[model samples]
Target: MEVKKKLLDIVRDTVRFKHYSLSTERTYIHWIKHYIFFHNKKHPKEMGKEEIEEYLTSLAIKNKVASSTQNQAFSALLFLYKEVLGVDMSEWNIQALRAQERKRIPVVLTKDEVKLVIENLKGIYNLITMLMYGCGLRMNEVINLRVKDIDLGFDKVYVWDSKSLKDRVIPLPLKLKQRIAVQLEAVSELHAKDIKDGFGAVYLPYALEKKYKNAQFETKWQYLFPAANISTDPRTKIKRRHHILANTLGRNIKVAAQKANLNKRVTSHIFRHSYATHLLQAGIDLRSIQELLGHKSVETTMIYTHVISEMNKAKLISPLDF
Candidate 1:
């Protein structure tokens, strides 16, 4: 028990040293704990590729986990061996029975449906939806937007450290420019109030806190979508305002969808999917869309092509028409 606790402590310290997100750190820890416990609390140092494979296969066969979930566990184990335990996992062949992958199409809304849902949302939620559809932003990207990220003069929105881990620039929608400007003004005001109350410091990613010294207290670095009230930072125990929770954004989207009476399922990511499909339907090339969406590969962006093809199928005439 003491050994496992000490190992997790090392893992936590290493993850923080590497500047991984809090959520990612937690996920890695969760999977690592599951792996250790599944093998009768055997220390990961005593295990190898075969044990890893067995555990992953159990996730597929017994737990019925999703393919992504299985991959997540694999990554955590890989990190445990390579980063924490300091073992060479490269030579060991791991042959795990993977969870079945389903190739279902992403759910997308029509442009009109997007409008309908947006109409039902108010204030920040409305703007969030616009950015997701207009800029093809992931929910995290939208929530993580800092004041400095918006280039109002240049009509650009800069997405930094997104899921792809690649920073990219997206064109700001002309219609939402004023809305975003208003949002910035609101954020600045809220930040000023927080500072006057002696708590304006926002969380900085990675070593930026060490590098910038005062960047955490800067208005430009503050989250554009600040929480309504100040909260305690779980990691630092600092009383600071964080960005709006993903759950808050997701819940609002659901409520808006219910109000809109739209038949299609709606989520924050559905807007992103709609954005890609809409761009494709407008004859934008896949490469341009790939860059705009910050996709690492054009193949990832190519999913929109399948969506387009499926939509076009509805327009095809039956054999009787020929």
Candidate 2:
């Protein structure tokens, strides 16, 4: 089989398994292509554990890629071998690459700095940032939020299909309820316009479009942060509503940070870090904070303990001992 034909067949088989996102599909294909090129156009079937080890070592030693990048390549190759090519790699003993110990702390903002950043943002961007800090939401989660996912009556935001395909409910800050209400009103107007223009389709996950058919067009399924105009779906080539672009929010965040005179580097995820740290400072239990941030493990939530310890060290002690 020709290499190009085999690559296409492998991609099709992977997609047929379902549940994979377009981003994952694209990444997997790109890495697989790179792997083939690295071996001087040798077919992956002709290569074995030795070739795989060398490719991974090249990624670490020569290319100097991060551990995560190498891991992504490993996963892609594993899928190609085990699933696409129907080969068992379980008995394979490939040499492992040593990953460096990264000790970089996440960038966090002080309470005043968080307030300053939000205050500098105007309109929709302001509301989005407030939710990021208030609910500790990831940038993608905030952008992918749908109308029905928010339960203002219960004061919780349903994070559906999150990072790990897990769903969790996080508290909606009472302080931002009114702001959310105003944003919802704007969303309602946009929803009405989309319906009138016959472009109300929402972007469904993997195979849901085939299952529900018109569920994408339902108002309840509309994006909370809808794009200003209709655009063609890159996969289906159908005109539909998509969420706000990440770059748009990214640019606004940079401008807002500058206007607030915050010298520290700030990004949308900084609000999430500040949210977790602020809760820790307020004496919230680690377990409770874990649930609020929708972290799967308490270990993931433990990073905030370091921030709290640093803050406590700065406190002035009295000269007189008890």
Candidate 3:
């Protein structure tokens, strides 16, 4: 038990040293622990590609996990072997029975539907949704926004260290400029209160806190959408204000969708999809949309073309209608 405990501790340290988010660190730890337990608590150094394959194949066949979930599990074990254990996984050539990946178009809300959903959402959630649809932000990207990321003078919104490290900038939506200013004022007031209470530090990414000793305590470094209360940081154990939970944003969006009486499935990502699709429909060039959406490849952005094509075809009159 002590050996397993120490192994996880080392994994956590490695993940932190690499500057991975807390959510990612937790996920990696969970999968690594599960892998060890699956093999009857055998240390990962004792196992190789064969044991890894057995565990992944079982996820597909026994647990019936999705391809992405299985892939995440695979990545965790790969990190454990290569990073933590100093083993060369390049030659492993894992051939596990892979879970099937589905090719489905993203569910996008219509412009009017977006307005309805926004109307149903209250306070910060409303502004967050607008930013997601306006800037094609992922849930994490918007929720993890820092005060320094928004530039009202330049009318820009900067997204940093997003999924796959795709950092990009977006034009600030003219409609939401006032709302953002109001939000900034609220954050400033809250930050002052926290400092008065002797707790004003915010979580800085990676080694930034070390480099800039006072950056974590600065108002610009604070979360743009902070949580209602200061809490203990799980990693550093520092009492600080953190950003709003992603699950809270997602849950509120779901509730707003239900209240809006929209039939199609709604998720935080739906707004991003809508943002991309609406840009395409507005005759925005594929390359420009790709850049705005911070897609690493044009091919990933091409999915919006299919969505628009399908939408157009759905508009065609059937024989009965004719």
For model 1, residues 1-322, the per-residue Cα lDDT tens digits are: 4444699989998998898888989999999999999999998888898899999999999999999999999999998889988998888989999999988889899989999999999988899888888999999999999999999999999998889899999999999999999999999999999999988999998779889999999999999899999999887788899999999999999999999998788899999999999998888999999999999999889998999889889999999999
lDDT of each: 0.92, 0.85, 0.93
Which scores higher on lDDT, 1 or 2?
A: 1
Per-prediction count of colliding residue pairs?
Answer: 0, 1, 0
Candidate 2, pairs of clashing residues: 202-216
Candidate 3 lDDT over 168-209, as tens digits, reads: 999999999999999999999999999999999999887899
**Can you give the TM-score per candidate against the true fold?**
0.96, 0.91, 0.96
Superposed model 3: Cα runs more than 4 Å off: 1-5
Model 2, span 1-322: residue lDDT tens: 6445666566756765766766788888888889999999998989989999999989998888888888899888988888788889989977867455466567799999998988899988988888888899999999989888888899989998788667889888899888787778788888788889877778887778789997887777888888888899776698987989988998999999999998999998999999999888888999998888878899988988987777777685777843
Model 2 residue runs over 4 Å out of place are 1-9, 315-322
RMSD of 2: 3.2
